[model samples]
Target: MNYENKSFSIKSWAEDDRPREKLLLKGKSALSDAELIAILIGSGSRSESAVDLSKRILNSIDNNINKLGKLSVLDLQKFKGIGEAKAISIITAIELGRRRRLEGALELSKIASSQEVFNIMQPIIGELQHEEFWIIYLNNSNKVLLKEQSSKGGLTGTLVDVRLVFKKAIELFSTGIILCHNHPSGKLQPSNADKLITSKLKSAGDTLDIKVLDHLIITENAYFSFADENLM
Candidate 1:
């Protein structure tokens, strides 16, 4: 029970008691948060095992992973054995976990209206500092077949290739397509360039027999819909 004087290594422990072996035998979900962090950190200072050091680090944040995520490398270095590499390992793991949660939470398969499209795509692109053009390809039931980034550009504008948009629609056998892009300036009003592109894409969609559902100009707080404005 006196751990301060012992320089324990995880590999010296029983196989079932080791973080890596336990994970392989019982699955990652069976490991505690500190155990996972132990695997990332790999080693500890002369006085502790990696798991003990990890537990101390986690306890310093009161087991709040959110607070731990906000920690810089310098902040993590306050822990006796956590160096820059170990700090980056913990930070990268936290980031990947955050993105995985977003992937699960952001599913909107059905495209019912411009509002629904806005709800689905807004969280992904609305607050961006640059322009990004996205296409939502839909099946006959208006269920989304796929969503893809068609183009990315500077703060002012993005160049969306009409041919590339329709090509993806054809490949997916999509019956309807929704066009979307963000305005970094937070302006909901569509510009002349916006109207021109909408007209051009609508015309192309008509020839291919794929319905152009709408073109949406999105901002963090609001959006302008070409279909709602009778521009489509």
Candidate 2:
């Protein structure tokens, strides 16, 4: 029989022929996003199948294979089969379900210990894609007043300026500052450059009469505190 003569109706096909029935008979993990979406879309136009359209969309996203976040309606409106209404439905539906992880830095509790501050900060800045240095400005009572990204780029002993630290501390009226940075490698071990930079900041803080409380090395999973180890 010629392939062109074959029937295309999904109902006329076998139990194994349908994506939905295959998922029900097997399990959900066995189905690709395209297969799953084919079920939601029901059927396709004469020119294209539902599965194909879904494949195009999933592929356009670089096959992320996870829940789509920030896949804007505007981004999807450019796709062939997806109109504004469909794109809006998808984006709004996804956003409604997302309870974004809030690593609360705005809590009223004053950070008493270096370790306590390290724990709170580890979740936010530790897992960043790029190297960024942050300063936590502390009030006279050692409570956090402002958290700001001090610099953005590679961190070396000579690259960081102590003036920037004092400038920010003065602007925030902070009596002390906690310096922190993330290790893209997740090592949590301070380098020779890190030590040199800290020593310079300590001297500057002494001259400026602003306390340099601690320097923290943050990794995605953990943190190393200079004060905790008596390095500060």
Candidate 3:
């Protein structure tokens, strides 16, 4: 009954309650977020189970996986049971998931609506900590020809080179383009600077005969569309 030195390892749990065993018995989809993350870390400290440690980590971020993904290795290492290797494992898994989403988004070849543009660009820039200006070039039929990052800057804003944007459009024979950028602050409202850049790009597109199809202010879970609001 000397409980002070007792171990609370995952191996001590019932097979059904163990993360790895449960994953093998049930399915990957059956596991909770903590269970999945426990499997990534593989083990826990002598006094806690992996799942328990994972729950504490998740609790710190209010169980927001997007917020979890934003954490750096040093950030994760601050957890009691997490070290450099385990932190790297978590970061790697999150990055792979992000890339998978990007691949899925790219499968949509045609852009028919503002929603489609959001679907395509959100995975690329939505959860970023800083700002990035992007352009989606489209052929005459609205099929995507290319998507490129136009600029990168701090949390406030990024500069878009209007001339370079059209230069690429002309080179690709793109007749239409969509402008997209992320607000790390999660604000959907277009700032005065946002409106100014949209107007600049729209006017430049007009002179070049390359239509500005839409301008999207992307956030983690939502977007603001200038075209949808009659601001185009």
| Cα lDDT computed for each candidate against the true fold | 0.87, 0.72, 0.94
* Candidate 1 colliding pairs: none
TM-score, candidate 2, is: 0.57
> Which candidate's lDDT is highest?
3
Model 1 regions more than 4 Å off: 1-105
TM-scores of all predicted structures: 0.58, 0.57, 0.96
Write model 3 residue lDDT over 86-156, tens digit each, in one string. Answer: 99999999999998988898888788999988888888899989999999999999999999999999989
Q: Worst 10-residue stretch by lDDT in candidate 3?
A: 1-10
Candidate 3 displacement at residue 161 in angstroms: 1.9
lDDT of 1 by residue, 58-124 (tens): 8988988766766888999888899999999998997787567547545766777888888778767
Q: Can you tell me which runs of candidate 2 are displaced by over 4 Å?
A: 1-103, 154-158
Rank candidates, TM-score, best first.
3, 1, 2
Which residue runs of candidate 3 sit more than 4 Å off their true CA positions?
none
Summed over model 1, clashes come to: 0
Q: What is the C-alpha RMSD of each candidate to the true structure, in Å?
A: 7.5, 7.7, 1.3
